[model samples]
Target chain A: MDAWFQNEVTYPHVAQEVLDAADSVRATLPNKYCDPEIAANLFAEAIDEYLLCDDLGINVICTEHHAGINSLLASNPMLLSILASQTKNVRILSLGTLITLRPDPVRVAEEYATADVLSRGRLEIGFVKSGLSEYASNQASPIDNGDRYWEAIDLISKALSHQEGVFSWEGKHFTHRHVNIWPRPYQPTLPRMWSATGDPSTAGDVGRRDMVQVLVLRGPEGTKTAFAANRRARAAAGMPKPTTDRFAYAALVAVGDTHEEGVRMGEKLMWFLNTSLRSAPQFGPKLPGLAPPQAAPGLYRTKPAAAKPGETASAAANAAALMNITAEQAMARGIMFAGSPDTVHKQIMDFHEAVGGFDHLSMIGRSGFMTHAETSKSMTLFGKEVLPRLKEVKTVTAGYNQPD
Target chain B: MTNATALPASGNLLIGDIELEVVRRGVGQPMLLLHGFQNIEPDAPFLDMLGDHASIIAPSHPGFGRSSRPKDVETVYDLVHCYLALLDSIPDEKVSLMGFSFGGWLAAEIAVKAGRRIDRLILVDALGIKISGPETPDIFDVFNKHPDEVRKRSWHDPAAQAPDYDALSDSQLANISRNWEALCRYGWHPYMYNPQLKRWLGHIKARTLVLWGASDGIVTPAYGEAYARLIPGARFETIDAAAHHPYLEQPRAFVDRVSRFLKS
Candidate 1:
């Protein structure tokens, strides 16, 4: 099976745990954790184990959180420079720096370009809107959030691709002076750009921009809306439709000899996420400009009555009483995919067909609360049993050109 | 237009210019506290912490708190320049700078320009460094999700529970929205700061302290350390049992750390 491992690295304390957990998996599977420098040594050790696998790659999605955990690491640009020197053959995907949140798109173009060049064109970028909490905590008004997000994207793209010395933009939210990004990206016309979103509008917007769409498989139904929106938007934007083969679908996956054991382990992790870890407060109070649902009472649940027809059936049900959805709905929707190899294979096929086929299937073998041993077991099971089945299924082609 | 008045009892130099109202307090060892993306008060723990040792100047950056929205000041750098002018108005030859969230980023910019005039700098849960990894969710996204889910994502400390939105007064919500708009004006840029700011840290000669809540879900600790390392000789610390605004959650610990840092 073609396997892609996806994980998040936060600050040092948490990142170390994530790296260690990832290491446990490397002992058994071809895996990599998109991590930062504070966890570099641990990541290096994980790589040592990972390299044992015949075909493997490491993707370091570097960011400021690494610096936030320790004072010695340089800021983003310097950190990217450091990342360039740290490893080889590992694809460096900048999940994305919020280009829209920046005042100078030219600078973003220049920096990411430098990063791509430094990493020998290993850079893959993803852009997103700065979270509302980030804006609020930083004292940015919600009104400017959307405008800034798009503006930054526009400027960055222009600066990265433009052959001329100057580019200009005049928007209601931001104005520029002699816009030009120095030191263009290593890849021709900038490395591939991706946009991450959990919302349909956002997914569609990314497709409209002709960028890759990174969809988090929160649940089966939500995934459907994301796929549908993306497809529709891509078609409308006159961009080539993203086949399941071009997209990456990520979900929390755990494999075991028996379906019950994996489910038990996965559920335990979910309980931790849904309980102990879920107590942190929202950054700021809601704002008027936000959509009604976003500003409404229940968090993360779409209101059932408002659910669009053809949206996930589970999402519609959850929306109706989102604050009160049972664990069964969450499980059946594939929010947390757990099973034996046979079960997992079936689920993968279903998901692949559901999304019209994904180029890569990334499993988050570790999360905020999962321990190393548990993740390792899941990784081992996946590598030995589930992967073979995935490899055998040749109904669809691989997404990107596989590394030689 | 609100009137400009200085408060002798609080030692606050108050400047109310139609669109903005600024409050400056304390004395001896001048320092500036740039408020976050929200309305703040004199009683905020960080302000209270530094009040004892320095001439603490806390301004409601235009379009926040009691500050009116000034048409003239648009970008975050504009606010930075305005604050620089405020420091120039003071009698002290130099000043220490501290900012929280958006203010922290502004302080960095001001310090870069003020150079030798800034003796020390502290940024608490500051924003405006660009790192590429897991996307930091926006406040709106958090609120849309379960409050508990948002909290878990942000706070390292279990004690930092989500705020009871139902309990907040209308005025509080209104103030938050008003300030959020102002924040968008300055922070809408992706990566939050000029990418050049990373390299510019070499220009800032002041001793710096970068502090964050161990559990902060907003900017994440990784972003915090990035800021600290960018500045020469900057130190980093995490406040236990705190989220994005440690000074608000663990006032005593927050103050104690600042007191020790400033003293050193």
Candidate 2:
């Protein structure tokens, strides 16, 4: 298993009363609340952490969100460039720069190529089918965003891999008359592609494309379901079944000297769900094309219904389940692993075993209010103690055990 | 051209590969009713009232009701072209084209292109042109604003006029969602207006009437007046105690006001 460390550089300094009063904590929140001095310190510390991960021999990840306290990384390529140029050894994955929101995917291709060259071919490209408040901030329509997402991926992939000079792309979502970048990617082929999705439909696409699939915060059941869909889709397509290496699970990971300390730190990570997910109706469930029209009964009716919201149904549904979740509950469901090194390891392996075994463990690191010192301490401990044991778990052919 | 009556019949119209859900009623000169943000509900009282005077042919735009929308049919331009094709299919010498809100935008576009095919044009709280300065938007952003605010802006008395979603059936809710999705796909960029439509409004050959809800916060009476001024010989009128959806809010007054214009 390969462990990747990630930090969202969350801003939790806003007054609780202000957060309570705002219709949305993201996109709609005024920029006046974001203190630049504090943001600078956050960037500095987060960069230091990335560098530390490089030294400790753990892979690093950079993700992007806009106009929100959840993350200051609005520009993934900017951070990708920083990590590409600064970090010495470890692989850097951009999980990534909301490609669907961008007006031009060719420009994204150029940015990725530059990062790849700077990193000496250590970059791994990842796509996120970004939605919700992101649509509002980016001024991109949420409707048909999926069509745009896949088209951007195709354009970026072709732009990177196609050696034959200037090519033209006329796609439904994007059209470029002349598509040529100055520098081709460092790797002969495009950096091993990754897509972050847990939905069965998107997971199937990931499987067919053979890209690594990362499921964030979805516990064993949801993860197992998505993996099964991936395997099933590949089999149906007459493609070889992907091994465990193609599947990855992301969760909050906080390792400490003692169990209580780790659990306490892990609880801090809950702020991501507890606060950052607060979005207005227009930017949340009401966003067009976020779900099928058939899902409208669940969304539009003011009266509560008896149907249990399946965890893997959609991100909005998943967000509802995650909000207000306790550290113990998160652990029991395999959404988190926090304890002494032995306990954290046991929790991870148990989760791995439960979800039919995945080779990549994306350890979503410190979140809101987790201080720089504490974050580094946990990372160092996790890197030094838990990672070696995880590495020993060999990649196996993936399979899904259906819940009876 | 007579097809108008008090009772309406629901059926499907096949236009090319697309099958459109349509309602036809009454027995008089042909009147093509272009619905607004939402498709005209079959039970909406104004439809039957309007049907009593003129034959009313109301088809839900692609992706709106039980309509089939091709993957490529996602823009207002596509809608205008589709409606133009529908006009060609009509047996009438000329059809009176009436549109509400988003449909008003479509009617204006169709009239601009349809030429002699459109005899009389009516826009009810229509949204198709820019009538304000760049910084000041003319239309309320229904998709971005708070739902309470949107509901309040949509009706003179939201408590009575606003839909109680809990009371609606699953299919009704699904239709609402489908309409919303289609609206967003067609109107999300440049925000429910065609930048060039204002410039072309003068070119419309059809005799025009622009109707508005006096209490419409979505698009004010002033914007409707400005819209009328842009179209040659177009007259502007407002219905009292009505908001964005005057037809649904005050069906009798809406029909009477429209009936007088059609006669004149």
Candidate 3:
């Protein structure tokens, strides 16, 4: 199965652990990770190990974390350069760098195109609107986010594909010079692009464009809802129904020799994420969105029961109550896949069947502050046991209608 | 409008001066199926899976099976352009496109260029992106040599591996070789398609679905996820036990997934 390694930190010691874990799972799995700098360093180590040891198909997932307040300042372009120089066969992906936050689409296009060339054309770029914190930190208004996103996408696309002259764009969010990027990507165009979205409307918008969408699994039913919405939007736009081949889903995974062991590990990880991580006194106050408590607890849960008009004091109160109820229900429903390899495999297969078909599956073994060893064991079990069982089922057909 | 039941039982459509034959069946919303490099027919296993829901159109790409070969069209881009023209010839204004294996690469190109006109696009075991993982077997190693070896390379379970390749006839080998050469001609570059295809993917305005055979040997599942992440509003599903041809290996699950997607 295709497995992605989530790089939560950039420490060298941690990087080595992740690399070692990746090596163990490499026999039965494909490994992917985020963070450009860490990826660059880890990739170098991985290549050496791979050459000396057995070859493992490990990939790096790079993200333009425009969500961070100091992202632009913190981002290291040199890391990408290092990655390009260090690795030969691994694919490098810009999981996405926010398009809306940057005013110059040409610059964004040029940077990614350069990266693609540096990586020998293995780059994939994902576009997203900077998170709320990014806008707040940059002192930008949220009203213009969507407009900027579309504009940036247009400018970047034109600059990458149309080779002849400088392409000028006049949009509400950005106006750019008539300058085309040099040294276009190795492919006829730049690396393939995908837009990441959380909302149905956004998913629909991406669907209508026939672009790739990465739907993060917030809850058990979230993928189904998003997939259905996208299909409907595409159909309503008078576009042909999406083929079943274009769907992808992400999940949190923990596998063990026995169901009890898996549950204990998953629970420990969740507890650490929820309680142990130290928070700066000013962190919650400074960034309201970052503080999970500030938002309704159940906001990410399944379809909440609609509030009866006038039943609650305000929408916030009603949402809070609904969320609590939904979380309880989800817990009872056993939505989270935590069990033995056989049980986990069955759960995943059932989930795939329930949501129709998904082309890609991403699992995050490290949740909150789980250790590298914990994550490694989980990944190993997944690669060895869960993946084998998943390969037993039939291939999903190409559905011509939108998903509901 | 002609209903699905009323459609003629004609053979596949032979298009282009090259006489590229495409099998067309059923009616209603148009659905096109593009096969990969294996030279397998869009047999009952595949057609029956998708036939009942919409008008099914399965084409045997040039240089594969019985389809007429195009002397000049060498690269994947040429194949993509040809397919775009084929869609324009169809009576329907827009049709859903599904590409398997190499066909998936062509489908991505078509979706990017045609955008909204193509409607929905599905890519299964697609080979466009240059992924960093286990080196995919060269076409010669897969299509020209022992077919069972190709299957074993991908199939995780010993039971699922195909039988001895020595028993295969000469024609099967010829078809395999021809298709492999075609694939190589189109996908020789380390990163199969334009690196910028990822960036251009955002421009496509059609709903997309990336379907994969979980045990696909040619492309890793990580590559599949990369495709999903690259396409906006795209969804990904992995079918079990299946290798490159999920439609052939896991027809029921494949049909169920497609049926649900179409209905939704």
Error of 3 at A187 (Å): 2.6
Off by over 4 Å in 3: A10-60, A64-91, A268-336, A388-404, B1-264
Order of candidate numbers by DockQ, starting with the best: 2, 1, 3
Worst 10-residue lDDT window, candidate 2 chain A: A302-311
Arranged by lDDT with the best first, the candidates are 2, 1, 3
- Highest DockQ among the candidates is held by which one? 2
- Where is model 1 chain B poorest over a 10-residue stretch in terms of lDDT? B1-10
Expressed as tens digits, the lDDT of each residue in A252-285 for candidate 1 is 6767779887776666445323321211123322
In terms of lDDT, the best-performing candidate is: 2
Q: Which pairs of residues clash in candidate 2, taking residues 3 or more apart in a chain or in different chains?
A: B3-B26, B3-B27, B4-B26, B4-B27, B4-B28, B4-B55, B5-B26, B5-B27
lDDT of 3 by residue, A223-295 (tens): 5666777777887989876654466555556677898787766664453223222122211111222212212
TM-score of each: 0.50, 0.96, 0.45
Please provide, for model 2 over B1-264, each residue's C-alpha lDDT reduced to its tens digit, 9 standing for 90 to 100.
Answer: 222222224568777766788988787988989999899888889888898889998999999999999888889998888787777777779789999999999999999998878999999999989988988989998888788889999999999999999899999989999899999999999999999999999999999999999999999999999999999999999999999999999999999999999899
True contacts kept of 1: 0.18
DockQ of each: 0.10, 0.78, 0.01
Backbone clashes for every candidate come to 59, 8, 72
Residue A48 displacement (Å), model 3: 11
| Number of the candidate with higher lDDT, 1 or 2 | 2
For DockQ, candidate 1 versus 3, the one ahead is 1
